[model samples]
Target: MLVEGIKSRPVYHGIAADPRARRHIFVLEGEGARALLEQEPSLTPAILASTEILYVARGSAGEGHVEALSALGADVAWTAPTVETLLFRLKAMLAVAHMGTRLYISGTEGFIGKAMQVALDQGMDYSTIPTEHRGSLARRVQCVHCKGVTEDVATTPFTCSHCGLSLLVRDHYSRRLGAFQGVCIDAEEPGVRPEPEALFL
Candidate 1:
């Protein structure tokens, strides 16, 4: 089962523009574009003029997000076919980001974690970054045994994509690994394993 009480599960305060910031950087994915779209009413010309939006529209929900986000009229409004492409660009930007720059990420849990990790790699303090949950409840899971990570995992007792073992998804999340822990389910019983359950979705 997906337990929300896990201490490490991130808390999203939604995506809001920091009016005092000299620049704004938005890293969005899928339905996450909506979070930023909702901020239009609060966005001033000065803020939009210095805003950079990177969006991806391949989420479980939302449609025509690409066109919608591009029309936001930010200084840099770009869309990538996938999250990987967006992260590459984000990393380059963060490397030389100036002071007073604010980073905001909105999307599925998996997307948020991966994007957050990228910002952290560049020495950005994640606690200062604002994030919002906007899409699927799917998770990024890492097999404790093989140390292999599986993305968008929405089920419990799911097979680990790497080691081919039936794994029980744990509520335990690892910020350093950017994934939830999955331990082998039938390790003790060998051939016995419970049926898969769609818990995280």
Candidate 2:
């Protein structure tokens, strides 16, 4: 989420040397990812010093990114237990729109796409600005016992139906299911059980 009413500065002599210009940039990191913002390392220190540097954490990675941003001297806030539900995503979009700042979204294509749509709906005029994208770790769950993909795992715990193996949700599974898979667990097996810890590459 970005702070509203941020102004964009112009580059001069191949450098953005203006120090008085205050810009609010929002960074969106995936479930287990972090935004370094190091490519523009020169601007990083200033970005950290800005009054409104908003970072949106959607998954397991949200906490870590928030911590890192704080270390950089950013005024940070974390929205936890996130918009895990579909309805929550809509609410989040509304909240983001009301914030009223130039949005700079960075994350998986799917996440960025949905957020951009909401920004557009709010009449933010982000049509000309290109969105920054980053890759996210795939969502995966381990099922040592079963190998079949079924659609009835949610009502029941994800366990191996055939061998009673516990299921563990791993970030690698994101590759198979796509970026948004972890947003919600649609199904699971009978014996598969969720892992206590989640890993993000």
Q: In TM-score terms, which candidate is top?
A: 1
Scored against the true structure, residue 32 in model 1 reaches a CA lDDT of: 90
**Model 2 accuracy (lDDT, Cα):** 0.41
User: Across residues 1-201, which tens digit of lDDT does each residue of candidate 2 receive?
Assistant: 112342321111211213444544454555322444443355566555552433456544534666665565554433334423422454464465434234455555445545555555656665433355565532223343345433223322334445444443322222232221221223354423444332333
**Candidate 2 residue 24 C-alpha distance from true site, Å:** 1.1
Give the 10-residue window scoring lowest on summed lDDT in candidate 1. Answer: 58-67
Clash counts per candidate, in order, are 0, 21
- The C-alpha stretches of model 2 lying farther than 4 A from their native spots are 1-21, 31-33, 44-46, 51-63, 83-100, 137-201
Off by over 4 Å in 1: 2-4, 60-62
* Tens digits of per-residue lDDT for model 1, 113-198: 99999999999888999999987898899999999999989889899999999998998888777889999889989879878898
TM-score of 2: 0.43
